[model samples]
Target: MTKESTPNDVTLAEPIEQEVEAHSEDNKVSEQEKKKFEKREKERKHLVSKLAQGNMDHLLTRVASVLNHYQETRNSDITLQTRYWEVFQSDIYNGSVIDPKDMYKLERLTSIARARAKIQNEFKMFLADEEVQVSRRSRQETEKEIQLATKPEIPLISMYCDESGKTGNFAIVGSLWVINKARQTQVRDHFSKWKTEKGLSAKDEFHFTEMKKHQLDLYKEFFDEVIKNSDALGFKAVVVDKTKIKRPIDEIIMDLHYQVVHQGIEHEVSNGRLALPRIVNFFKDEEDGQEALYETKLKQHLHSQFRLAFDDQLTLDLFNSVPSFQNVYIQMADLYTGCISRVLNHPKQGEGNHKDHFAEYVLELLRLDLGAKNDQSQDFAMVHFFE
Candidate 1:
């Protein structure tokens, strides 16, 4: 400062000192930035680790709940039971202790168990209600007072016979309801209705033809009604007119026997035996011409194991002993003949027509057979006889 310095020296000295100070400042700022960045990176890593741990815990809890639910719902002997046990054992091996937060998962599982138990209880209640209703209805029927005649030692069996006339166009059905006391009023009233609804008024050919169809329909209707009243009437047996429909009858009989065996109807009867009355068909007469041929073929097709023969004495005796039999026998001789006649008269319709008609007959026969056997035997005694 005392000696006057040169302008160049002064300029050089000032520039060097300022440059050093600026470099020192830049170094300090870089060191501070590095420390801040390292701290932020460490915090991010810690947060990611915590989030990953939480997700893993949540997944494990859900898995445990599902496994517990499966074990509870599955059958005791099922393979799933073993599998769940294995998983539980593995979890215990790894770490038996569960975190307090996982207790909620266990609670969720318990809730599901409670809901399942409630559903089971509701289902049982529903079943009980249904059983109560059935019992009430049965009790009402049993308590009703009605004058029922003492059942004969040998039950009365009636025979209902029917036949089809010329070309199977006309059907004739006859019912012999055997009454031991012979209620003339009941018989007269019933016959009057039957004759009006099913019988041919004029003996003319045309009237007879119409009567045949009417008779068949009426027979079916009557048979169904009698069956419905069988329990109330205390009938021992309900004999269906098998006759030309032996094949159909056999099929129905077999089905009834099957139902009795498989469906527990036998256990419901008085003697643990289903007491479906015996069903038999009249032997077809050879003198019946083509009708006889039809009967023979039908028997062969339906029950090849048995042979058919008409014995007038047997038929007459059976008819007369209706009072000794359980229920009435229904005959569809007229309906069968009429169907045959219709088929023969209309031959141009092709073979399918006969097949269709026969199939329909078989189906109807099956339905009737099943209906008769349904709940008919309480003791299911028929099982021993047939099985």
Candidate 2:
């Protein structure tokens, strides 16, 4: 019952031919990819060689933190890679040597947006390793528990900021300045006592527009306290007039924020106000897609304007915190800005909102120059107007 195969039939030759051709195709593709990768590596090495001669201190000293806050998990390779390239370019621009491993890391870090948290963790671990090595060189370490117990935390000037009416004609950034560690706890305790006396929880949130009808008095008391202690604890605001701007809303907002923050920090240092070991400015997380790009840009502008202009001695940390958390300081910014927005935007609202009244009343209380522009550096607040 066996039948002999026909000569025209494929038998094994067609599959064998097809597989050989496929193999050849694969080899061709792999060769091409290898050539492309090599070319890219060569170009990167060339760039790094050129960049190694310049100022590399920014690489070791400057901190780039991304919160991975955009909420989207899908990796955007093109954008991320472009950012990595940007980071690589900056490393060289700052005169840092580009090792193969770091270039590889840059490739990995820039390839996926979700890798932000992982990158930060790895960076932290790297810093920790460096600390261990430095300690080893100086002296032998004790057990892990002992080391952990002895680790000291460096105190910093914490600046909590929030913005309101971002899309409206007026944008305001309000800031609450506080010292970290024990002093912060003391201030929080005082604020909490005021809240408890007003029949509110210490954990209760404070927002002006959403205040209950009876909470008006509580709001007034809090504002008065801020104004009263405006010396020991500080609150400041920078306003932007958007009606005069011709750019898109998002662009305008980012630029104004940068200018406000930039000018604000400079205003502080110029006046001998930023007298702490370091400064950490926390703003609400706004950019979901371009968090890394935006954070890097902001930090660069701050460093360029404030740090480089001086001795690069100042350490500025920019971080993003969720707006709806237990950040009482950010709430302070929101409450302060809410008051400013009401008075500045609704000049015609007769019988002003008490928050607005409090704002204007504070100006009178401090005797700020009514005739002078708000942009003038006052002892308490400095406002920036875009020309």
lDDT of 1 by residue, 259-318 (tens): 222232123235422233222222221232344444445444323222222222111111
The global Cα lDDT (0 to 1) of model 2 is 0.52
Number of clashes in every candidate structure? Answer: 28, 3
lDDT of 2 by residue, 1-387 (tens): 987778656566788899999999999999999997687655433322212111123332112211121111112323333434443455532324566656555544433433432333433311234453344233234344244333332345556666676656777776666633224545655766777787877458887667665666666667677666555455566776777767666565555555655566676667666653444444552335656676567556656655654444445544444443344566677776676666566563677656556556545544443234356456666656555
- Largest TM-score belongs to which candidate? 2
Give per-residue lDDT, candidate 2, residue 299.
55
Q: How close is candidate 2 to the true structure, as a TM-score?
A: 0.55
